[model samples]
Target: MQKGKVLSLEDRIPKIKEHRRRKANRRLIFLLTLFFLLIACVVYIQSPLSQINQIVVYGNDLVTTKDILSVSSLKKGENIWKINKEQAKKNLMAIPEVKKAEVRMEFPNNIVINIKEYSPIAQIVSEKEFLPVLENGTILNKSTLLADAPLLINFKTGTYLEELVAQLKEFPSEILNAVSEIHYDPKETDKYHIYLFMNDGFEISATIPTLAAKMIHYPSIASQLDSKVKGVINLEVGSFFKAYDEEEEKSEGEEER
Candidate 1:
């Protein structure tokens, strides 16, 4: 048979129209589906169903959750998108004890706040109360007496404990770990008397700047000490050590000798 050269123009016109109609329908259906999806997303994001239903706080001990939430300006049931994260973080950090603040949002209704509070390295005695002092030189809440860390004495005069506290910051991590107590007397400006109570009964005498250097080798120095001797290991002048008796006066024999 003659292949009929395909179809005539009249027959091909109807098929062409049908194909165009089907293509238009498909495009319309696709557009409608995309439009509905966009609407649904907008509704879900704006509705209260997607708003924050829970507020979680972490890494905070001294500061209460309520205190942080109150200052944060982030309330429950508020839209997550409406909350100003940067402003909330700034407000939380404004609190004196708060060292760092982090604010984050979890989808489907959750707000998480992570906080880092400053730790007290020493106690500052002011008037009748002893206040906890942070590493940043800021004074925190008042504490009665703490046996864990050392108490800084005589911080009023020009020989205030600020110098010692500043020096402590530069100390090596190993030395800082071994240190138990640091004491200062303002009357003697150039000298600092540090009593390091080791796990053993030995006490270490460390002068201001020398303390940091000596403490680096504390373990080795401690190993050389006689177990029977219970006295001060003075690291005041260079590397020389002077072992004083328990009952010996602090400065009595130095001037006499």
Candidate 2:
């Protein structure tokens, strides 16, 4: 058999050296990449780029953006990553007018706060101005009259006012929207008597107990009435319409005499 040729030390030495050099080069490249990445992360964290730049507020009407931001405890220079969204929302919701609140970080350096404020359902007549009443029955003297909200005439701060708010909350939005004013006019037989003035030029006489349930069908009932006639809707008993015509009432008065 032919003897195997032995590789010269000079030749094998170069091959081993080249393999080691390549391995070292690869290791060096990996280390440098890792080192640069670590430095970049440190720089990013220390830089203002990681901090909040702007606060964007939405869905607010009663509570202003500044008020929301104040309660959120979020500042422009603070780190966005450090903010607790849940806690921020909780703080915003603690406000009397805020119904719901959501806080979100719009990456890099922005905070998005979306808030839903409680709309005033009705107002209590004060000495000269009307005090806004929320659905939860908290009165706000600072709040002005909302054009669409009904005025609560002859209403005082009591359970009746709270009950009024609770009942108003259940009404369909359109039915409630149609109302312009409500007057508390209690009779001897029914202490819950109320006179509601509709924006459509009709007066509705109803009680607090059945206000929401009965008013739900108001639009349907209004469709059946003559649009030209101004009348008082009596929901105190079975729903009925008595025309406010002077001649008719006079005729009835004469008959009673």
Candidate 3:
């Protein structure tokens, strides 16, 4: 083959220089892009845009949003990325009413907290003031009473009241709603005695120990009785019905006269 057209040193030197220049230009472009990216990241971390701007609470009723925020120690303008989600949740769970809690970051500058609270089974009536009693045997401070919740009277914070609360915990919603009031009428012979006044104009007498087991069948018992006559449905020892003395006396007088 004819001597391959040999590139003169002058031509080869210019080509090599051009190649080096292109490689250097590419490296400079890469370094400049990296430098700007790092600066942008630093600016973002130091700016208010990275701080919490809003906090939203969900699934709360008995416990107020302000209480949750106070417990969590999460404040607006705090660095959202630095918050410990698990710790915040633990703080919220410490509340007597809060049964479950969850905390999460909503990106950019928002924090979202979700909570679930224990339901109030009854309202404890103390000197005409009503206090909500939770299913877990916790008595809240005097507050608005729910219309459907049964009023508990003459109940002190003691073993008897705790036992009664435990029994009421297992009551079906329908049966529990039918109860208008529960009076702790203990006697020397039976310290666990209780009287339940039903919304359907009937009364129930039961001991705290056997309350849930016997009262689960309240619907059936009430169904078998005459609705017009208001009487005590005693579930103590055995089930029976006894009309109030005034009602019986009225009936007797009506018959005699």
Candidate 4:
């Protein structure tokens, strides 16, 4: 084996000093980088860049964006990091129309609020004012300007109304839109009996229990009838059409002439 190389203490001391200097330099550089990073973080946190410059709302209807922001209490100048997302969400959920709410912070300074609002399935006619009825069967106290939805007459907040709303929830959009008005025409035998006035000049008699199952066939039933003929379509028992008595009488008189 070749003899190992040996150095004098004076030579080894310089080499050790070089290694220590390099290590010290590396540690100094790391500390400086860390200090700069911390300072940058503090400056960023205190700057306007950390503030919410814009607040955007999505998936909101029936509840206006301004109203949603008011409820959330999230302001444009508020720091995005300081906002309590869960609290904002809870506040949004308190709105009667809001079914779900989500809050998130976007990069650089944007706050986005996403909310899902309950849709109005029908409007109740109360004292000449139309109140929107949500899908969950809660009738709003505030009157609405929208007149396209079906008008429900003489409906109280009860199981009957709840059941009716639930039944209407499952109705196809076309079929639901065809309905213009619904009257709670209860009978001694059937408390759920309802009278529906259709947009196509036809009336429908159905019970709440069988409304969804039977009304799905209304389009096909109405298609078979004469468009000019006015009548009532009874869906309570079986699907059938019956012309108005006046129309039948007029037809008979014309036949005699």
How many residue pairs of model 3 clash at the backbone?
0
- For candidate 1, the lDDT comes to 0.74
lDDT of 2 by residue, 1-257 (tens): 99999999998999999999999999999999999999998998899989999999999887778888999999998987888999998999899999888899887789999888888888888887878898889898674867878999999889788888999999988889999999999999988899999999999999999999899989988999999998899998799998889648889999999
The ten-residue window of minimal lDDT in model 4 covers 140-149
Candidate 3 at residue 180, lDDT? 99
Off by over 4 Å in 2: 1-27, 245-257
Q: Measured by TM-score, how close is model 1 to the native structure? A: 0.77
After superposition on all CA atoms, how large is the RMSD of candidate 3? 5.1
State which candidate, 2 or 4, has the greater TM-score.
4
TM-score of each: 0.77, 0.81, 0.83, 0.85
- Total clashes, candidate 1? 0
Model 3's TM-score against the true structure:
0.83
Candidate 2 colliding pairs = none
CA lDDT, every model vs. true structure: 0.74, 0.90, 0.92, 0.92
Task: Kindly give the stretch of ten consecutive residues in candidate 1 with the minimal lDDT sum.
Answer: 181-190
Candidate 1 lDDT over residue span 2-21, tens digit each = 66566889999999999999
- Give per-residue CA lDDT, model 4, range 1-257, as digits (tens): 89998999998999999999999999999999999999999999999999999999999978889999999999999988999999999999999999999999888899989899898999999899999999988888889956668999999889999999999999999889899999999999999999999999999999999999999999889899999988988899988888897668888999999
